[model samples]
Target: MAKVLYIKANPKQASNTFLISDSFIKAYKEKNPADQITTLDLYREGIDFLRERDLGDMGDPEKLEDRNHRVFKYAYQFLEGDKYVIAAPFWNLSFPAILKAYIDYICISSLTFKYTEEGPVGLLAGRKAIYITTRGGNYSSEKTRALDQGEPYLKTILGFLGITDFTVLSADCLDVIGVDKDEILRAAIREAENLAQKF
Candidate 1:
């Protein structure tokens, strides 16, 4: 059975982004009922917060520390998964810091990746990811010129780990003026459901 890692980043329980994410989860579960799903709520459940020891542990795997143990355990769990889903709200034109920290924990040296004379090699393979998000402002218009730090960063990081296939479903202008959030969300759910069928 495939193991799925579901990361949720919305702090507000009632937030539209969270609801959309939950919808995606429901659809994913329906499609792949046998797949194991692990949900990580970064805001409420707490992520592996960065610390000096966590970095130090990467250099020497032989040494065991409390923070290092948590980092290793989290990395193992991440590597064990076959699929990953990141559901987060676009915050301040970017993704949340908690997600960033979680990435830091997984992408450690001699763990999820390796450095060679040629280049960096991803230890984890045969994995795919899906990004589900909602933004307050429309990033479609050139006049808005809004930068989407969420998708780009996620793509880069996952690509670094050799996850090549991923899809993004975004509902922009969620809180912006004159934008109908309910309509956008319904459309996003339809799109998500379609993706679920293929997934």
Candidate 2:
């Protein structure tokens, strides 16, 4: 059975991003009944960002091997997951700062990635990731897709960790003027469910 880690960044149940994620989870569970699904609510978890104390741990050879250390806690958890689901809303052309903090916690050497003569090599190779998000503007087009830095930024980070199978399910133009919010969400929810079956 695969270990699925669902990372939720938004707190609102009615959020378009969360709704799509919920649909995907429901579908995924139905399709893969034996899979172990764990939900990490970032808002509720209250994960801390890197600080002075963490700085020293990152460089310590002892802490790298000691998984019990606080510095390796989140990174260890992240590495253990076989599949990942991240849900967040677009804010300031990116996701929430808490999500970035969570990434900071996991982007550790020997856990997520390591340096090599060739360059940094990611450890979480062959893992799969699904990102669910919503944007106010239409950022799906070739002309505007570059404006949405959240998806690409996340894909890049996860790729650095050896996850090449990255999928993004975004509900775009939800809050656009004269756009039908309900219709936009419904389509996204449908797409999310479809992807979960094959994900």
Candidate 3:
């Protein structure tokens, strides 16, 4: 059975984004009851930001400290997962800073990826990732697509880690005026359920 690592990046309680993510997880569990699931809530965990000292110690094994060991442990957990699920809400055209910090911790050189003569190569190949996000505005349209940095950034980073096979499930237009919020959320939840079965 696959080991799924679920990362929750939303801090808001009773949020639509969190509710939708929960729906996806429930469906996934139903379909893959034997599979193991590990969850990491960035806000609740209060992950620290990556600092210069940490980066230096990361490369120097002799200088590793307790904090560096913690970071490496996080990276090890990332490598152990067969699949990843990141649930986040759009914030300032991207994701929360806590999520970014988590990304920094996991994307370690010579760990998640390495530089080759040709270029950088992802160590975790053949794994997949699923990104679940909610945005207030409709960024799918050409007029506003350029403003969407969250999904695209996520895709790029995951690709960098050799996780090219992935899916993005987004519930947009959440904050649009006159839009049917309940309808949009319900539709998104349905979509999440469907994806989970296949995931």
Q: What would the per-residue lDDT of candidate 1 be over residues 9-80, giving only the tens digit for each residue?
A: 877888777677778888879988998999888777678577897677667757523333776767777887
lDDT score, candidate 3, position 158: 91
Clashes of each: 0, 0, 0
Residue runs of model 3 more than 4 Å from their true location after superposition: 62-68
Over 1-199, each residue of candidate 2 has an lDDT whose tens digit, in order, gives 9999999998676788998999999999999999999999998988788899899889998878877778787888888899999999999999998999999989998679999999999999999999999999889999998888899999999999999999999888888889889998999999998999998
- Residue pair clashes in candidate 1: none
Better of 1 and 3 by lDDT: 3
Error of 3 at 32 (Å): 0.3
Best by TM-score: 2
Question: What is the TM-score of candidate 3?
Answer: 0.94
User: Better model by lDDT, 1 or 2?
Assistant: 2
List runs of model 2 lying over 4 Å from the truth: none
Against the reference, the lDDT scores of all candidates come to 0.80, 0.92, 0.89
Instruction: Output the lDDT of residue 93, model 2.
Output: 93
Candidate with best lDDT: 2
**Per-residue alpha-carbon lDDT of model 3 for 1-199, expressed as tens digits?**
9999999997786888888889999999999999999999988988999888778778876543343486687888898999999999999999888898999888987889999999999998999999998999998788998998888998999999999988999899999999999999999999999999998
